[model samples]
Target: MTDHLPRIVVGYDGSASAGAALDWAAEWAELQADEPHEVRAVIVGTAMDPVLGGYRARNDDLLERWRSEAEQRLAGTDTAPGQARERVEVRHGPVVPELLRAAEQAAMLVVGSDGHGLATGTLTGSVSQHVARHAGCPVVVVRPRRSTVANRIVVGIDESPEAGRALRFACRRAQRTGESVIAVHGCFSVLAHVLTFDGAESELAARSLAAGERLVQEVCAARAPDFPDVEIEPEAIPVRPGQVLVDASRAASLVVVGSRGRDAFAELLLGSVSQHVLHHAHCPVAIVR
Candidate 1:
């Protein structure tokens, strides 16, 4: 069994959004052609019997039909000719748990931001959000976009280790796609936490902005050598981190951010800024854990 091989697992339910996600996943897999990995689409069906324990006759029929549909959808995805056919895995259980189980040790999990059930299949509606917060690996939530700026990746940067991981992920992607990386750091929120100078609010804000600028530059500069080919455009804006990232997402092919940030609560699975960006970004958002 090639279960040990790295895999890019995608949640598919035959919805339009799921189709878009599959396309995005395919593109990502192609980008990593140098490093071999399997692209598997997981189709989840609700297990009808709660007390009876497993798939009954009706449940079996639903799962089989969904499996067939998933296979057809995989065949139709616009991947390069001669590429290995993507494998389809069918699981019968609650949607989120089953998807999480399928991708427990995957390289990454791709899911549509929203999806209708398989005919009535409760697969992706809010499922992406839950999985993004709970998934053991990185999660990329692909939302339908009316337009996208070409060859650019936006990433939120801070001093936290999580932010560093995110920047590395973005730089690696930039290396693969020949895209420029926009490293954005926001100052207002960071400053508000430590500064209590009421009368000299403006002066403190200016200092915070400067500090933020330095932090961004230093962080990007450190990673610059490793990704010499990647163009890192550092932007230290005097705005909230989440807002800056959301605005930048308008002109980014993808937005990458840490699962949590500097001020995140220790027990929280996802940070406020990351959560905000996930909900409002104009393009695909990748939450790096």
Candidate 2:
């Protein structure tokens, strides 16, 4: 990789979701204006055990077949002329570690959701979740259904440095693509709503909503002047933040969220709302640390 070009690593498995991931990475790289970008498609598979010497030849054949398939898939994607340079890499090992290694020099790591969950049927696979949690750079998990409008980037915000990072990323992307930013803040207090009387519950709910609105406004205001041309839309909704963001993703070009939020436990790599959005959002999701 050249020092002037940022690299993007994508885990390609030839699955539908994986194909979408490849496409998203390519498009994202093309949108970068600071410098040229490169796309590396990594296909990871299990290594054949050396103990099975009798089957070594068979294993080698299987690996060759997998590599060929990956190359074909890489060639099938649409690449813009004179845009990001592309390459395909085949590795035999655990998926998470290989991807992490590949991402060491990458600007962002991208993977696709398997779309096999109960809520929205688009859940991050175990490998993707692991890499997203542990990668050195930001990670993007592209869902199966991407928005065609390409007009808005929705970001989930709270009082965390990770959220601030996400906001900055969204702003950069908006600057490149001319998309607006939707700063979303969701407010829900279980204790206040479930453990209090009617009047008290209403008052608590109102207070929570007001606080959410203020948080959104403050965060957006802090970043707005820097991105004068990028329209910032602040949304404070009286609902679960994850759900609200997921709903907003239906028409958004991309959904950005922090790896961990204010309520996340210290050991948790991803907060509950971020995880929820990763699984349910209809557009590409970016998890920023």
Candidate 3:
């Protein structure tokens, strides 16, 4: 069953975005050749009931055709020869749930921004959103367009544990690809605005910026020893985290963000900043939970 290999699950539905996602996943698996990883391309379809007694065979044949097409598409993905270890899985059920189940044992779950039934220009499909928020492991949402910035990975930094996890994930990727890591920390102080009327706005703003810089440095310093080879560029911005990350995404190969932050409501599965970046980032987004 090759269960010993690290598994990566990708959703495929014969759409352009899905094809791009498959290619990304295959290439990612190939890059991990030294680590021995496997890519599982999962194609999900709803179960259909026969309309009549004689329609049973027709339904079965249609399902088989879909499976065959999925297999062919999986085989056509561009990957390093002898480096990609992949398999196609056809399941009868809803897409998001099937993929989530498959991700139970997978190292990562990947999907496209748009799919067969998903609308265009929406940034992210409904299925991708659901899975990214609820997947057991990290989720990578790949956009259709190929990324031009392949030399760097951008990750959001905060006080949450998930933020630390995201940083570690980005560092590991940077280590493997020889890419630089951009650690961005966004800080906005409500006290600075309130103190504006009291004539202390400038003083408070400066303090806020210094605090932001310290927080970023502290977080990165703790993990610096573990990823000594990864080049880290830390930026403390005075804007919303989502906007800063979205702007950074324009020149980033990948944007990694925590699913939830320290300020997020307990009941929310995804933080507002992460959600915003997932929908507006130019390149692929990875939600680390």
Candidates ranked, most accurate by TM-score first: 3, 1, 2
Task: Please write out the lDDT profile of model 1 over residues 208-247, one tens digit for every residue.
Answer: 8899999999999889999989999999998888899999
The parts of candidate 1 lying over 4 Å away from their true place are 1-4, 50-65, 77-84, 118-121, 190-201, 266-271
The global C-alpha lDDT for each of the candidates, from Candidate 1 onward, is 0.82, 0.78, 0.80
List the candidate 3 regions with Cα displacement exceeding 4 Å: 50-66, 76-84, 117-124, 144-147, 193-201, 266-271
Q: For model 3, give the 10-residue run with minimal summed lDDT.
A: 115-124
Report how far off residue 98 is in candidate 1 (Å): 1.0
* Candidate 2 lDDT, 51-151, residue by residue in tens: 66656676557556645765676566565554544477877776678789989968999998762211221224776677777888999998755568669
Residue 78 error for model 3, in Å?
Answer: 6.2
TM-score of each: 0.86, 0.85, 0.87
Instruction: Return the top candidate by lDDT.
Output: 1
Worst 10 residues of 2 by lDDT: 115-124
Candidate 3's TM-score: 0.87
How big is the positional error of residue 238 in model 3, measured in Å on the Cα after superposition?
0.4
